[model samples]
Target: MAMAAARVVVEAEHLLPPGGLAPDAVQTPGPFVDRIVGLGPLGEEYAVVRR
Candidate 1:
C-alpha cells in the first residue's frame, strides 16, 4: 500500500518537464554521457586506449 502510493506520487510529480528527473530520464540514457562529454573527459580515454 505504501509503495503504491509512493509510486503514484512520483508519477504525478514526474509529469513536470525536461529538467525533471524521472520524466527526462524516461527516454534518454541519463546525463552521465553529457557530463563526461561536456567536460572533454573522453579525450583522455581515447588517447590512453588508442594505438
Candidate 2:
C-alpha cells in the first residue's frame, strides 16, 4: 500500500458510521490505504478496516 510505505494524514469526520468512507470524500479509496490515524486531541494512531 502506498500509504503504508509513507506517511499520510487522511481527512475524516467520524469513524462509527458502520460503512466505508463517504463516496464523495474518498480520496485514495480502498486497497491502497492499509490504516488510518484516528482522531485524537494529542495525535493518536489506530488501524482502520482492511480488505
Candidate 3:
C-alpha cells in the first residue's frame, strides 16, 4: 500500500516540466531514500544478500 502511494508520487514528479521551480526552493526534511531491492522468485534472496 505504501509502496504504491510512493510510486505514484515519484511518477507524478517525473511529469513536472523542467525548471518549474527554483533548484534550491525545496529541501527534503531529512535523509530520504528509495530503492527497488528485488523482484520475482529470487527477490527475497536478493534483498537479504543486499542487506
Candidate 4:
C-alpha cells in the first residue's frame, strides 16, 4: 500500500508544471478567506489555502 501511494504521488508530480504549481497573485472567489489561485502544468486551475 505504501509503495502504491508513493507511486501515485510520483505520477501526480510528473503531471504538475515544470516548477510545480505556482501561486497566482489573485485570490479565490466566494466567502472563503486566505485562499490563493494556482496553475498547473496543463493549465489546470487550483484553489490553494495556506495554513
Higher-TM-score candidate of 2 and 3: 2
TM-scores of the candidates in the order shown? 0.15, 0.41, 0.22, 0.16
lDDT string, candidate 1, 8-29, tens digits:
2121222344565656455434
Report the poorest 10 consecutive residues by lDDT, candidate 4: 4-13
Kindly list the per-residue Cα lDDT of model 3 for residues 1-51, writing each as its tens digit.
Answer: 443445422212233355675768535311232532333354655666541
Provide the lDDT at 20 for model 4.
54
The better candidate by lDDT, 2 or 3, is: 2
TM-score of 1: 0.15
lDDT of 4 by residue, 1-51 (tens): 433342221222234443455557223322333332443454324435322
Provide the global lDDT of candidate 4 against the true structure. 0.34
Arranged by TM-score with the best first, the candidates are: 2, 3, 4, 1
Query: For model 4, what is the alpha-carbon lDDT of residue 19?
Result: 43
Candidate order by lDDT, decreasing, is 2, 3, 1, 4
Candidate 4: regions farther than 4 A off: 1-29, 42-51
C-alpha lDDT values of all predictions: 0.37, 0.56, 0.39, 0.34
* Clash count for each candidate, listed in order shown: 0, 0, 0, 0
lDDT of 2 by residue, 11-38 (tens): 4546655465567866676566656665
TM-score: which candidate is best?
Answer: 2
Question: Which has the higher lDDT value, candidate number 1 or candidate number 3?
Answer: 3
Task: In model 3, state the lDDT of residue 51.
Answer: 17
Q: Record all residue pairs in model 1 with backbone atoms less than 3 Å apart, i.e. clashing.
A: none
